[model samples]
Target: PAPTAAPPEFLLNAPGTWNLPMRTALASLPRSVWLLGLVSFFNDTAGELIYPILPLYLASVLMAGPRVLGLIEGIAEATGSLLKLASGIGADRMRRSKPWIVAGYAVAGLSRPLLALAASWPVVLVLRFADRIGKGLRSAPRDALLGASVPAHQRGLAYGLHRACDNAGSVVGPLLAAALLARQTPLDQIFWWASVGSVLAVLLTLLIKEEPAPPRPSAPRPDWRPGALPPAFRRYLVVLGVFTLGNASNMFLLLKAKDAGMADYQIPLLWAVVSLVAAVFAAPLSALSDRVGRRRLISLGWAVYALFYLLLGLAGEGWMMWALFGFYGLFMAATEGAEKALVADLLPREQLGTGFGWFHLVSGLSLLPASLLFGSLWEAWSPLAAFGSSAALALLALVLLRRWVGLPAQDGR
Candidate 1:
């Protein structure tokens, strides 16, 4: 008997089935989504080219230690987070997201070339701050735009695809750096070459057209305080704050890799492996959230984080470290997109920018204390204490999330 073909309508409408065909999933998105994804890809490429090397550079070249690394990342992210809150408000008032997006990318792009000239830790800190300032200005508005471009149902897939592109660039950037380093290229020269990707990313942003915001009656200005947001949204932010406290900068992980006997040139290769896994899995996992529910996927990702952090504390050999790093990418791929999509689900259309702003602010503000605490633990006790403590905190946060946060009304699951 010949098998009957399923109806096209069935494939298109079925829950959890949209992401099964990668090409079909992509074809369903708008042009703006693709453009924004490409923009992120190039932007991340430029950033990651320097990122994986930065800890090593500071440690070896400038003789900075782990605590200094924590301080720099904490300050940079905190500054960017503050600006993100401000920019989200500004984007809402101006009702023109593209300008903010362009300016932010341009600022960060312009700052990349200056790194080649950085001779001191303070100089690097200043440059890093400037780069984050650009990120702060653009992130919320850009996410708001992406959320607007896709339909309510497709938000997860859109964000997931965007993250996938970003991670893909992360993979490429390190591979490029590794190739150059293998040929004995100077770090400064690599930094100079990175500027090309930044330039290209900025140029691509010029072509992205914003979706026209729906018309609305003029009304009283809304409150900016976190208390004014819906109860569900506010509670979600609280859970995120809890989770982020356990989430220190990945630089610490790289530092751990080095301490575990991974060589300097091999560092970028290891970084690439993590990014490749993220790039491959990010979209599919995020798409699954669109069907299963964001909370479930996010919770699962945190569970994975807790598990790995515990194992990482026990890992000693180079192969064990590499395996841990590779699987750790799963945590990133699962959470990043689903988290944003959940934000979109929680907020009204007009408030998306501000909502995302507050979201980033909460995450960013907690990061300083998180990194400092992690670094302090490492310095005071041992790597085991640092990683183990993070794992415990992650589990606590997971419990809070499950008990306090209810599923959003729109989440069919």
Candidate 2:
């Protein structure tokens, strides 16, 4: 059965029920939504623990520089983007999301243990590639499942809560890494621990009761055709591609933290702070999107990103970096879940996996050039040049979004 939409519970005259809307909304969510968030929480806890410190490991331990770091991240993201396109279509055609979801988690889980043995940057790059391939495999189907698990009004709530849960892991993961580093624990030990978290995510994934996929028409050729999707979705992808051209990996932001005179030991702690702030705000911002409108929220989030990028370039002190990073967290809260909800909003129920695949694909592919450009600019001129360029591109994307995304002045959602 389809998930039931919540009935309006607005009652201005009712005593002591000011929170009725929220309570009703919570009551309407499927159990799978919350369970899925927990699964992601564990999986991301594993991933973010490794994310915060990997750049430093590559630079400090493997004797690499900004260019190589950029190269590795760019390639890894590009590889995953390609696979997401394939996996999204596969989930739709196969009509079962759990097997692919399970396989993806298992692959990602087993790959992390190998990172403990990576003495060279090339080895690290390969492992990252493999790990992202696993991410690529699971992302679209997972999103489709989440959308299916809730009603339209509740999508932002579900996705937001999921982001909150996922970022909560990010918060803990970095702090965990910080604690381990402070104890003079070996890097290999941290990687091993990350594997433990990944395994937990896999186990939790097995507990999920996946909703069967809606059927699709048979086509001899692949279902990867972008033109065949909704016109609105296609247009949204266009603006998204332009915006993502400037949105590089958060590893650069971690690198920015280091450049702002944060101690090496403090980097993960700083990351923890960012994740903590994002976790706190993700649900509220996404819920606000449900009340107001997704397009407005998304545009605001992009503007926040632009402002943060510009501020990051100008930051000179540790305190300045701290403030800018907080804004970065706010941007993630405002956009991440809401963006996915907006995509699902724009497309039909049956087209969600494909739409989300295209969505992730455009965003993921843009990271390659974004990181490479930022890294080269850092190597050539200064951090100011790299970040200033990112700000400029982001502003342009914002203008395009405001002017051309074609959202109505008053949307019902």
lDDT of 2 by residue, 1-413 (tens): 34556524332222112266655665667888888788888988998788888877887889998888888989998889888877888877676677778888888888887888998999999999999899899888889888877777677778988998999999889989889888988777788889878989999888988766555457443356987887767888988888887887788888888877888778888888888877887876777777678988888999999999988888888877777787789889989989998887887666677878888899889989988998999999998899888888888887887777765333433
What tens digits encode model 1's per-residue C-alpha lDDT throughout 142-250? 9988888877677888998999899999999998888888898888888887888899888999999886776667875645678777788998899999988988888
**In terms of TM-score, how similar is model 2 to the real structure?**
0.93
lDDT of each: 0.86, 0.81
**TM-score, predicted candidate 1 vs. hidden true structure:** 0.94
Judge candidate 2 against the unseen true structure and give its global Cα lDDT, from 0 to 1.
0.81
What TM-score would every model get versus the actual structure? 0.94, 0.93
Which pairs of residues clash in candidate 1, taking residues 3 or more apart in a chain or in different chains? none
Top-TM-score structure, candidate number: 1
True-vs-predicted CA distance for residue 197, candidate 2, Å: 0.8
